[model samples]
Target: MRDHLPPGLPPDPFADDPSDPSAALDSIEPAQPLDAAERLAVEEDLADLAVYEALLARRGVRGLVVVCDDCQQDHYHDWDMLRANLLQLLVEGTVRPHEPAVDPSPDAYVTWEYCRGYADAMMNVVEDD
Candidate 1:
């Protein structure tokens, strides 16, 4: 059979396999590099994440709960996972899929806005002291 693979691309190992998992997936385009503003935004998020983790972790907060737009559901990400995802976006221009925390306690996670407000309040208290 004639090879239809693109130049420099390896032959598909699952070409003749009936159970090829990728056969069900549409081809995904390469992720675009972050623009200057996007890069800045991600950097700021990373900095804020560090502050949030430092302040909240000691208070028994596990992590932040984000509302996923694609799935329209709440996704709980621990501090480590959040940092890893942000770093991945900075380095690879894409975030690898991560499994949500298993049986996460909703009460232990706060929204990003809550974190920001908490941080701001804490900063004000520190300045006033």
Candidate 2:
């Protein structure tokens, strides 16, 4: 048995474990930058969202006030809910179908119009191709 082993080697650290040892460590590269127009739109979106988040944090605004584009009414969503909605829209290119009633819970959400306006302002500033 001694002669069968190789030199300058160590036993497997997790030989008894089923998982890959390297799974505990991983590295990722930074995301690629957006193009000029894309960069501006993204920056604008981020800036507006940041402000909304800050408002939520500082003013204890509870939830943002947003106007719905589909139904022409206000839809209220809390931070978690609003985040979920934003992520959903980002993935799907459109918001969920339903429109919540106006005058939602005191801390539910803001109108979509505000989000659109904020995003639009950024887009508007960009030079047309």
Candidate 3:
């Protein structure tokens, strides 16, 4: 049966093994390149991240808290890590998996909406002054 397998398809190395490690892993399709609109959106996110980091970091804000779709849990990312992840996504078309911060303080991280609101409020205050 293995000999008759289709061309270009490698024979499974663990066909006879009952404990194949990959058996439980889902096959992931290759990442597709970002379209123009997607690229623009990512660029905008990067810009917003820069401003958010600059404005919030001074006030003891550690980073952003993002909810993970895969795990359905909150993940805390520091400013530098978030920046690097965004850059990697822009260049590689995929974000690399990373371990979340160890025992991060929930109060130190804010959501994107909070950052946006804070930035807007800061702008208004500046304008008022």
Deviating ranges (above 4 Å) for candidate 1: 1-27
Clashes of each: 0, 12, 0
Q: Backbone clash tally for model 2?
A: 12
What is the lDDT for 94 in model 2? Answer: 37
- Report the lDDT of model 2 for residue 126: 73
Off by over 4 Å in 2: 1-43, 98-103, 106-129
- The residue-by-residue lDDT of candidate 1 on 17-129, one tens digit each, is 79987765547776899999999999999999999999999999988999998999999888887887887788768875545678999999999999999999999999999
What TM value does model 3 have?
Answer: 0.77
Cα RMSD for candidates in order: 8.6, 16.9, 10.5
All candidates' lDDT scores? 0.83, 0.51, 0.83
- Residues 29-56 of candidate 3 have per-residue lDDT tens digits of 7578888998899999999999999999
* TM-scores of all candidate predictions against the true structure: 0.79, 0.40, 0.77
